[model samples]
Target: MDDSLIIYVVASMVTVMAISCWRRRCQKSLAPVPSGYGKVFKSHLFGKPTIVSTDPEVSKFILQSVSEDFVPFFPGSLTELVGKSSILVINGSLQRRVHGLIGSFFKSPILKAHITADMQRDLQEIMASWRDDQIVYIQEEAKYMVFQIMVKTLIGLGPGEHLQFLRHQYQKFVAGIISIPVKIPGTRFYRSLQAKKRMMKLVKYIIQEKKKNNTGCISRDIIDAFLNDGSGQLTDDLILDNVIDLMIPAEDSVPVLITLAIKYLSDCPLVLQKLKEENTKLKHKSLEGEDLQWMDYMSLSFTQNVISETLRMGNIIPAVMRKAIKDVEVKDHFIPEGWCVLPYFRSVHLDKEIYDDAYKFNPWRWKDKDTAASSFTPFGGGQRLCPGIDLSRLIASIFLHHLVTGFTWVAEEDHMVNFPTVRMQRNMPIKVKRKNIDILLS
Candidate 1:
């Protein structure tokens, strides 16, 4: 045989072997496990080996008892984009201090008042823009409305060129949170990084303006609150990171939940009927006409149930990633230090043992079950639980109140997809019509 031919044959063999090995590894990463394999399982995701837990007990332990042993594990792309000081990835004293500062504000009476006033005004404006029989993209409209509300509530931003510019930059920045980490020009990561830089600059300007305009008194909005913080714990970077962290979820997750709630209501007419009945009664009982009060939202039982069911089914945040800082063992599974552990939240939400007809969209199931039980952790659990839970629920309830009370919509999309995020394939277009004005009042 010729030397050239022999060399070509050897190269071909090597290529085949490499391809075979890669394929096998990919299969192992994605393979389905047997029923008896304990709650914890080892798997590979995106070519990186990690441990995943579907056990609620283990999840609770990791999120609460052993929280110090594991820290949030963000992809290289996300850490670079969100910055190092973001509360989402930080731990220890810094996390607590940041959390205490922000948490106090979020839970304060002033912020709640602001949220109520802002959400009502913004929601009313958004609803007013919808003409009878108009085809509205639920996801797009919800995102715009929620983003506006979040900006106004969090940073005191209002309709203007700056808001528009920031909105555009934010859309780009969040789009790359899950993309490849390559920094080459024109890549998603590159665009996202550029967008992040613009956003940070904008935030810095806002912070400086807030500081310059500070009155000795405390302020209602988050930016003003941080600026007036006397402890000196809040650095510019810390303020920017936490604000961006909060904004990303407010922009992405909450809107998705709102859209999903609309989608579910459209598909499940019985649930919609119950929600409408509940909200309509409240609408008629409102002594202060034309606006909903904080108390009114709190009294919405069936409507809240629908929101809970929507969250459970939507699974907007499907899983949370954590890295083990120390070796841990739960049940029979041993997780070593430096390994990544993922708590598959969707698994628990959809577990057959916990929920009857788990695959079905049944809001009534929540009527008898304990909605706050650990089994349902859509907002997560323990110390790191989303501090915005009350705010998120309030937003959902307010939107549902307006929607069910004033308008009726029909779903234009037949399906929703959940991968990187839960969203309708066609953005969930809906044809909305105004309900009888008299009926809304009655």
Candidate 2:
């Protein structure tokens, strides 16, 4: 080989090797891509092939399915924990019936009034225990208050041994919601199942007692609502499982929503001031010894905007899962039959293209925005949508009303933890002091 010929041969060899190496690197990088690309993609989630969608239109389609194309589904551990017979697991006509029975009662004006009163009383009691300059953990406090109110609303229990026992067992039950599916002895799943059993026994006893004491009265609470159902279709198991379902949010999403709102308000002073100003007007209107009605709280436009923005940024529920009963194609993304489909609300909520300055905590953005749009799914969307949406909003609004109106607080250093669940790193500590408005309320 001459010098020129050798140089050409060596350069060609080197170029080929570099190309091969680059090909291998690209293949390696693409190997474990969960979901392919774009707003809709495919992945294996919790051991099942899943179609993950961040597109609002596809999400709306999946959530609004009335046919067999999609059905409510959860991970194995969650399905087992909540039980196969849970309202969450059941589908079609039966699920609708149960949902309607509970949802109708939950949405009735009578229940709303009662819920507002219960929330106010519980919040006031919780806030009363806070002293000036005290560093209160807002997460824990909100959880305590929300749980008590939920207990009262569900089974009409109020601050006693029964309530205490249920709360203790509930902690154990909730611990396994996202754990491995194994139910062996000493496992979190096993303990949670046992907790559910204990909770069921107590709840059964309470139901019987409530039934026995009934004097043909109107429904006073959810227990009464269940008992008064003329359909005769609501069995003991149905009621027990569904009541447990309701408690999940009471301990998780609802409190977390309130906590996140507080965190956001703590970070956004101008937004907090506007919320306080709006709520303070309602506060003054209630100063004549009148309890604020359900409408009074919901009618607070700015407060609702703050709640909307908080939910937009918080993404408490984040994503919801469904099982495809049939192979479906959404916007060129194909979901195989029986595959899990997750509509990731968090993505859409935080997508900059969808919302200008999406990362910023700007409540004013919601002032003229369309909250009913497909992009927002804080409490979820469609038929299986959270029945407690109104109730949760009512609770948060009432809490903010009282907190911002009667007191001032400086939040301790904390940041949001999004994965595994949305929660505060330090449970959102705040040093609070009573404001001048407290005296007027007193």
Candidate 3:
């Protein structure tokens, strides 16, 4: 054979070897959801992305107790994509302390102040176009508005224009975490990386400025407080990542969740009108920091139930994924030392064993307070059970309180909405009846 033939053969062999190794790594050890994820494949060698852990107790062992065994949540693909700045990747004793300091920022007053103003104002701005009876892309709108909410409340209301510009990049930065590592031209990873770089540059610059100026306002938002206070407990990198990470879904949670609730109420119009009536008595004077400090003030029976019900039905993430760190047993199955497991939250959310008319949307299910806690945990559960749970609830409630009590929101899309298709699939295109708005506080 000629020398050219030999070189070509050698090159082909190396390419094949690389491909084989990549496949083996992904199959033997799960990687991550690719960036710009189109559709997930359920199985390793099969058609769709299959749910690995079918049983709940199996999920519990991995997600909860077996933390000692697993590597926390470091997937090579996502880590390279997100880098190490994210708190979601930060594990061990140090993470515990960051959680503590960050926890302080979510005070009752701070949250209440956020809900009444920041959350409400942003939503109104996004929906103001609806006053013209314009057809708005709610899914995309939710994505944008929520991104802003996350930015302002989690960071600080500094520069709106810069925030949104940076936020657009930040969201891209976030989406990059799940992207394929192909950094060629027009690749998701390339775009994502560029976005992350843009964000980091901006955040680092701002942190330096604030430090130089001596704002002494680190306690203003979760990011500031985490980096500055509590015995210098958290690192600056962790603070920046957490700032961006936690800001995600600021509006998505409420809007997608509210959209879900609207669907439920659509099928049961009586419930819709009933909720409006209950909120009729509420003053639109706005919830303040003081009011939020006391959780019970806004914990109206009807309001809480509606928000809680939305959470139950809208367990957004299907299952929390975790791998076993050591030998663990669950429901007669030993989820060996290295196997991954997925705790399908949808199953728990609709488990016939736990709920009545499991498929039905019943806000009253949560009216009884303690009875509702067991049936719902849209955020999550246990030690890592969303520290921002209270604030999330407060935000959702305030939004819903404003929504149902104020203008009429109708589906601009088809009759029954889609679900399981993708993120917030069930959400319908809704238009606001702004002229018919009811000013409750007057």
Candidate 4:
């Protein structure tokens, strides 16, 4: 009956009640409307009539629909920040043209090799800076490392003044991605727009320089891909818009994926041990001091499974947004013209009926499963599948290889937040110590 004890009990009760209320609210929002559409619901969202589908078949149909039927739809804040001409927003022939030019380059062997070397070298450099029992904020390290690699790939820039400046501006630009759409001074959106102008000014200079020096020559970076296209369809503004757009995924999803994998692995000791063993065996096979090739990394079957599981659970991109260009019916569900249609991938991914022990992180389950199945669309689907999917996977695979083989770490208290974006609450802090290679290999 002490006063302090009474206060503590009351606070606990309040917290429980708050959590219960939040859950109930979420359930109510997700529940189908009075039309009894089950997995499909009609609701007003983002100031428009919307059809939100959690059914995999319906979701797949919408994603695979032709551009004439459904096109990319983003919020006002995102559209303004991403630009009007970005590959993210453009549709039909223009979008296809850009997608073709970039997709081929993104999947080329040269690019893959470059990414592997850069990721390994940069990861090694960062890991080397870690001291024994140091509490490394992996979110920061992952961002630093991934951002540098992405900049190099995009513009062929290395560690120097230019990269640093872009990194600084990029942080401001990203801050406004989900901010209120006000362009006044001191606002997140305004700062983001200003930051973008600065970054684009630098990129424009780089493009001008590239045009002068490279011309028709094949440069390994993305700029080269744009420059060397014989079609003559791309303008400087389009290239600039797409470059800034591409940088969004670099700063957002890839680093988060790496951080999430580390977070999940830290919590699941058995899975971590198995993953480490797989990568360690690969390490043992390559003892000549030669850098591991892209194939070498890709061939790690179990490592790939872990990446698959991470993508499934991570759901870095929780939904695909599109506006119906015309009235359409998906799996007997009617979608009105010009309405926002969202295929909620997160709901499907976490469905208990689809994945056994759905909420659990189990990489082994992927061993017998087909990642190409409709149930697994982490990178979206159809022609709009993320072009950087391979690159993202390869980067993560290499990072995990080096991380598990070269060091040991204990993750600090942290949790993953899914809404807005999937990110670690505490920047995924971990105390890591270098592992002796001699002992580890043996």
Of the candidates shown, which would achieve the greatest lDDT relative to the real structure?
4
lDDT of all predictions, in order shown? 0.79, 0.83, 0.58, 0.85
Q: Candidate 3 lDDT, tens digit per residue, 279-309?
A: 6655332432223223443656776777677
Q: Which parts of model 3 have CA positions greater than 4 angstroms off? A: 1-58, 74-76, 121-129, 215-218, 230-233, 251-254, 284-297, 369-375, 414-427, 435-442
Cα error, candidate 3, residue 434 (Å): 3.0
Better of 3 and 4 by lDDT: 4
Give a tens-digit lDDT track for model 1, residues 355-402. Answer: 889989988898898877878889887778888887888888888888
Candidate RMSDs in order: 7.0, 10.5, 9.0, 6.2
TM for every model, in the order presented, reads 0.89, 0.89, 0.77, 0.92
Clashes of each: 0, 1, 14, 0
Better of 3 and 4 by TM-score: 4
Runs of candidate 2 exceeding 4 Å displacement = 1-37, 215-217, 438-442
- Poorest lDDT segment (10 consecutive residues) of candidate 2: 26-35
* Top TM-score hit: 4
- Report the C-alpha lDDT of model 2 over 156-206, residue by residue, as the tens digit: 888988898999999999987876666677777788999999999999898
Quick one: RMSD of model 3?
9.0
lDDT winner, 1 or 3: 1
lDDT of 4 by residue, 17-130 (tens): 534533444345332323242676655555566677778998999889989999999878889998888999999998888988878888998889988988887888888888
Ranking, lDDT, top scorer first: 4, 2, 1, 3
